[model samples]
Target: MKIGRNEKCWCNSGKKFKHCHYGRESEQAITKGELIGQSKNIRSRKCCYVPKALQHECDRRIVNAHTVSKSGSLIEIADSTNHVYGLKINLANIFKNKGKLVPEKIGVNQASTFKGFCSKHDKQLFSCIEDHPFNATEEQCLALMFRSVAKELYAKEGSLLSSEVIKSGDKGKQLADQLSIQKFAADNQLGIKAALRELSDFKDQLDGQLLGNFTNNLSHLIFESSRSMPVAVSSIVSPVSDFNGTIIQDLGDLNVVAEQIVFNSFSSDGKGYVVFSWLTKSAIILGFVNTLIAIDKAGIFGALIRLFFGLAENSFISPEWWDGLPDAQKKKIESLIMSGVNPFKFDPKGLLIDDGVNFSGWNIDNIRKINF
Candidate 1:
């Protein structure tokens, strides 16, 4: 079980053992401040959306683009202080919350924002969804899906880039702890790499459509809420099960690139919209969508709340509504939300079913399906 000093590190860091983990236990542990700084540095490196044709059109300044529009969606749910509750996923915040992820009050301007696009392209590309009303048009749906996927792609790349900082926690730890941490990091990196490949492909397709000024091979389902919901979210999920507890895709299969679908929810024009968008002719996603439609109109909101907390992390909650929930209910929802993003958690079965918890009282007014 002994590794040669010149051999690759047991942690799979692609460095020799002597240069990577050898004598790591004797080193000083990475301070919390260091980890925070490293994370900030990673985030500070901006990424822009510049296709081959638009490279010359990109702006010099990279802006923090909102996946969920700030002017239209987030402002509708902001409290008196213009803030909303967002799940903080940093190591310091997680440790502060006793090793659990919790929703922290964040300014609406900062919530759901990512430095994923330049100012010029951000304005030009997302004008339909960002500047105007949402009527479930093909352009608007494509914009919605584009922003969701782009945000997710940026996030996954960040997580992958932060692996070294994460592995630094193994410093000054016992060999067993170091092994556990490194193994988890290695496994997580693999997952992120797989996700990045799929996201890059999807983004390329979206970029092609944007460049061609056409919408093709896109499908969407839009559910109109009779009233505004207290939450706004933009995320991508590879669904494993449906509302009926039937498995539609096996997310555990390492060889398969799991089917992904974009789920976005926001309030616009005095009503709420829950949108699901995906590529064309995906039987797996189609089945998943069918189960969602099969849910009774009365219970659709509850089903969506469960599914959102179970699978998505880019969800924001109105401070007023979240504060009104009972402590036990909030705890239950937090656990459900963490189950989706926590690397150590593995229970993905029956994530969309009713769990005897209802977080929304809004009713579905209409359901619209679009194929193009």
Candidate 2:
């Protein structure tokens, strides 16, 4: 909300404050009894139409989503234009120490898709134990194992992960010895396969330890990326501290990636929402959702959002009103909003109203009045 005196207006038209929406008339109209309360005749040029115009436009196009996550709760702020969304994933349930492989914790931190690459990563090392003999170069073989391990836990671009239920490593080993060393050599004909098999069960344990370290580093990078914005919820499913506390090189760069994501998310949201928010800066549209309604559906908003936010003309959304948008356009909107966010202030939390209720869920009680 705080902008510098000479800053490019967040409203984004390329003009200075003296010439933009906040021009002379706008500066004068904020006085007396006109700007704050609701009035049906607000569209008249002499009134508060200008400020309301921006808010209303933003509201009309902005997408409102509420998720009941296993972690906690999620509120996303996006429009056909801006992609900056905020999710408050709660982990209070997991830290209680009662459950195994906490879904809530993993979902909040990792946000994995449960698809392709993650599955393969898990099976990689085990597959190697089946194929290559022990005489192979442990380092390179380990790399293969690392990739496989990563795939199991991480989702890859393309591949089938086991849909069958997975067993805990400890419990699975106690019950089924499927994860083994000798089987690795029998399956692989590599030079070191046989030698690796001779290293004993204790060696596999060491390999597992090393694998944890490797995965931890990768997971850390993934986590920072997810939280820092441009808003592609991270694909990782666990927190980094779980990885035995290994320190990584270039931690600073990881944060940069986070900033990139955050910035992109906001910009995308601003642009996508422009579909609703961008009117004749002259119209008196106000409120977030109202902004969306103000859009002229024909091609004006679509053009501005696309040209400015890089959104396509069509995007796929299922709400009754959303049917008006095409899938490609929606995707483009998402991409543009994501690419234009601000990293330092990433993730668009819900707007700050003068204590308004956020309607969500089916029950009438879902509406909680706020006094703040």
Candidate 3:
């Protein structure tokens, strides 16, 4: 029979279930190499990303949420089913090692996810955002995706801080300030919630008109072997910050808010640049720039920015230059441009390596291989 956390332990230890075997089941599951499914912790708290109007009802039934959707497939630099790339960076070790890189065998999984949202909001609100990336093309689609991810990241940070506040032994002004920060984060998330819901409705209207074209564009971008594509996409197994130490410091100055997604668009010397970055434990960065910039040059810049400034700024071949070209011709140019960049040149310490039988010329796949 099942037992409640507050009830006596089934083992008859004369202690509460929580203090006795409440969490042991999870521990055993982990030891046995099984996924724990989801968190068993439930509390009487409002859905963190729910709209203000629904706040009252949200508190009545809350569920553990996944920060990143589990459904989306991880974007791979090179697609080979038989070959798996192993990342030897341990994120938890970075903090314990006093900000030093400690390499360990951390298998990279495309399906990695974290828990933090209510079931109702997850299905109704965040699912659209999660699904957008696969077909994202226009700026509006990207904005909606970024905003939704940012809200989830900030909410997770606030939840962590709140837990710390509760666990702290001290009770004083400092504790009050911590609580205030947590509340501020929660408030910020609500604004994102309202914006995302509005965007979702707007996106629904555009879907009928834009989705077909967007899907066509995406297919051309992903499947065509041409080098002229104006964008680059790459995924890393560890936290983005662990790969770049300076980001931890640079991000601190952007704002007091936790884990902000940085999106920037600018033009320099007759070239356009677009950068979308989500600063999470695992990050997928999408970059679009003028095609004039060499892929290797752009890769170098991407690595340095992540290393020194936690950003990427590079010139791109102008879209106006190719505006009238046939769609077929344009796709070829885009493919060539994408093929030129070495996406994996930035790991200064050589932490990322490819172990699969087929090593596609993807820059990330060629970086120094570590045999941990």
Best by lDDT: 1
Model 3 lDDT vs. the true structure?
0.32
Ranking by TM-score: 1, 3, 2
Deviation in Å, model 3, residue 326 alpha carbon: 41
Write candidate 2's Cα lDDT for 295-339 as tens digits: 333322332233223221112121322334566644544444443
Candidate 3 regions exceeding 4 Å error are: 1-47, 53-64, 75-115, 129-133, 137-372
What C-alpha lDDT do the candidate models reach, one value each? 0.84, 0.24, 0.32
Q: RMSD in Å for candidate 2, one decimal?
A: 30.7
Candidate 2 deviant stretches above 4 angstroms = 1-69, 73-232, 236-331, 334-372
Error of 3 at 268 (Å): 31
Please provide, for model 3 over 88-179, each residue's C-alpha lDDT reduced to its tens digit, 9 standing for 90 to 100: 22223333555433212222232122233456655555555445443333443333333334334443444444433332212223435434
- Which structure is stronger by lDDT: 2 or 3? 3
Write candidate 1's Cα lDDT for 1-372 as tens digits: 599999998887799999999999999999988888888888777978556687787878999999998988899999989999998777667668887777889998899988989999899889998889888887788788889898888888899989867788999999999989988888888888988998888888788877775556778888997677788999988888878888777666778878888989999887899999988867788888888899888888888878877788899998888888888779878778777565566566656787777665578888998882
